[model samples]
Target: MFRWYQRAQVCYVYLSDVSSSVLEGDSPTSLRRKPAIRKSKWFTRGWTLQELIALARVEFFSKEWNSLGDKQSVLLTLHERTGIAVRALEGSPMTIFTIEERMLWAKGRETTREEDAAYSLLDIFDIYMPLIYSKR
Candidate 1:
């Protein structure tokens, strides 16, 4: 359950299977409110092709990438979301970004070469790919 307190800019979320007293005297100043705008599960906001590609990269290539089948998983997820076919996603090496576009891709416009810094195609496929493509 979620309660919206507009005046205080506070939102109270009640999780299942826990004591309710924790929230008895809470105030917005005491709560950890994430500023990000979270989309509901039923809502898929419009996505530009570039945004999709960029997000795919980040989601697939996060750290812990070596834990499982990453690339294949991302391909499968892309296929499922797009119906473009896994083979095609994997086989086609279409350039997701051009050299000139790198600046735009940089995380927060930081032009750092540090591996942990900005955005790239390799990052996305390294993590969620296997889960997405696992043949069950």
Candidate 2:
């Protein structure tokens, strides 16, 4: 899955609980609301951390699939909310960041399976480990 996302041209991030509500204001940015994007559940999943950093291009959509923005457009919001540097979010070489910093990204994320928290990081660290799955 990591390889697939890495080679893909662009990834679409769907915010199921978010909406592009229009709010009137004087500034030019007074078009689509930004608060909801910050509150999305997508950022809480452990798997999403690797998925987000691995991709070069990521397009965001609202609940109804409306064009919310792309990675470049919403870069600041993503950085502020995730505490991830812009360079990482921009798909820089993973080696640029220390292993400790990388690990911090997953510190508070939640994963369903016990092994999956570690599994999802294989791609992030460029470590290849065959997944051995068996029925419980």
Per-prediction backbone clash count = 12, 0
- What's the lDDT for residue 1 in model 2? 64
Expressed as tens digits, the lDDT of each residue in 1-136 for candidate 1 is: 0011112222122212222233235554113111111111211212222233333232221122221123343344444444333433443333453434433333232222443232233332332221122243
Q: Candidate 2 has what TM-score?
A: 0.86
Residue-level lDDT for 11 in candidate 1: 18
lDDT of 2 by residue, 1-136 (tens): 6787889999899998886653235645423446668888889888888768878889988888887788888888888888777899988988888899888887788888878888888887889999876567
List of clashing residue pairs for candidate 2 = none
Q: What is the lDDT of candidate 2?
A: 0.80
Per-residue error for 5 in candidate 2, Å, reads 1.1
All models, RMSD in angstroms: 18.5, 2.2
